[model samples]
Target: MSIPDTASMPMFLRAEDFSFSDEFSDLVEFSFLPGRDDMVPWVEYSGGLPPKSLWGDSICGENTITIQSDMYDFLDMGALSFVPSDETLLKILETAEHNRKCPLDDRITLGDDIPEFNTELCEYTLTIARSITETIFTRDPYTGIVQEHSPPYPDIPRFKLTANPWMVSTHAYGAAFCHRIHLPLVQRVGASIESGTLPTVFKPVFKPASFRRNNVPTLTCGTSGSDVA
Candidate 1:
């Protein structure tokens, strides 16, 4: 059976009003997964792995590291600390002294003086600071004017929704129908039948000469009948 083009058809039926069986609901959910290929589960790995330190212990081969779960609980209110190494601590002190002498809004400007700070850590810290500044200040860089950060409106695709809600919801039901329903039905029917050929009821009508044109070329006799052209 042929299905009508849902895109060309008007949406007389709203999805909310439609009733579906539990089995159909399960199938719809299964179909939805394939459509959303981009979606990944939040928890990728089942096992928990302990964090490793940047510098490996050269002398004792064993360095005991303990992490209190509460300290790094970002999801909830918790206190975090920066326990720097002896080397990093010295660099931090130097940077603090420099800041006290000549304070700068941008941490990146202090990079020349603080050579001990790792490139990766410096970039990461600067990036975070810049992002925070942009959010808090919300200023026009060219004009040097501070603007209020306006609340962002919901970015819904109005045109696509208005054009075809059904197509958008089902990711075009034709693909889902063929994969989930029609192909499976054909396979089942094929398996049941003893004969290799499909049943007459399932066969489509064939017209061998359907494409032949009615117009045909005819030979015209010359004015002089004696000469056969």
Candidate 2:
């Protein structure tokens, strides 16, 4: 079945809008539908399924399939850009700070005498923020075409420490990253259909996959309002 016109266009594009190599194209197919023992040709040809770090497990059902992936993974794969929002960065920072002070007895701790602010963590945060905000990506949601805006993000502060962690509950990095992976899959599936290679038994139906993020409340116990002493 043909994809609907509205959803036909891909939602991701390469940096400078360049084309992906034939090898990469082949990799994408194998990457798709991972862990399907029934279809092992692609995996067998490619020296086994890719590591979980690069690709996520495939979620399959009677009618639909969902693939999960990390933003950095795609970026490593030559994705033009993958920057988590300022909010996500802040939350990550907050969680890191909170967890540093409140380490679980079971899990390993960085050290007993943690500094007021972790120098390495702070430096890492700044580096990631710079990488993301350095290039403002104004992406077309439907076409996946990315237009680079100079001067980066002007309004949103690169990073901010929220006094009240409770005020922040929502996380968007997963959803954003989900789209990053979704667009490519859509593009490839569409190509398969056009090439008359898509399985005849399967019907083409695309649905908006749901992405979930864990809040600090779930990860740590006790009051997140103040540091544990």
Candidate 3:
């Protein structure tokens, strides 16, 4: 049977806009691996989410609304590290680093300094020194700055999350493996340039888009596994 058009239905919903309901929260917990006891459990809390001021200013700019929701509110932020799949990817990044023109005072390049533990699962140790506040989005305008590198990570399209959160959480493991890069390097160098810091760090920057919605007012959510920055 064909579904009828309902006036009350939401015309559209952006992937960034989502609910933090009890049922979805439970699903988020279930999606985690068995031994992640260190990860905090989702609690049933009332009232609204942490203030907009708490997340700081919008990435889009001032006056525009910026909203973000994570699976674990109390997640410990630290350096995210992973080994390159092969020498080709590393070579591409190294070439990009050399080609980019920047003032010497503001520039920091990894060059040929591939970590000794580059092949293993190691934490990007440098991130430990940075404050948690530094990692999140902020008020600074993006200077249209970009570096040329091979497609190091897969496209984490927004529309993908509209499907079952379980699928996204599961695929996040795969994405983590695929998305691995030396983010600590980005963190250190960005700290020098005002516009470089936050944008270098991976974030779900919202954009204007349109799509149909379902009946239930459900929210999009996922596990920390997807955060393979």
> Against the unseen true structure, what C-alpha lDDT does each candidate score?
0.21, 0.26, 0.23
TM-score, each model?
0.17, 0.23, 0.18
Q: Cα deviation in Å at residue 43, candidate 1?
A: 34
- Per-residue lDDT tens digits of candidate 1, residues 18-103? 11111112111111112112110100000000111101110110111112222112101111111222343344334333333432
The TM-score leader among the candidates is 2
Scored against the true structure, residue 47 in model 1 reaches a CA lDDT of: 6
**Which scores higher on lDDT, 1 or 3?**
3
Candidate 2 local lDDT, 136-200, one digit each (tens): 44333235544554443443222222111111111112222433433332233222212322222
Preferred candidate (lDDT higher): 2 or 3: 2
**Tens-digit lDDT track of model 3 for 122-151:** 221111112222222111111212222112
When 1 and 2 are scored with lDDT, the better candidate is: 2
What's the true lDDT of residue 151 in model 2? 46
Model 1 stretches with alpha carbons more than 4 Å out? 1-82, 103-110, 113-115, 119-229
Candidate 2 at 18: error in angstroms?
A: 7.5
Full-model lDDT, candidate 2:
0.26
Could you tell me the TM-score of candidate 2? 0.23
Worst 10 residues of 2 by lDDT: 162-171
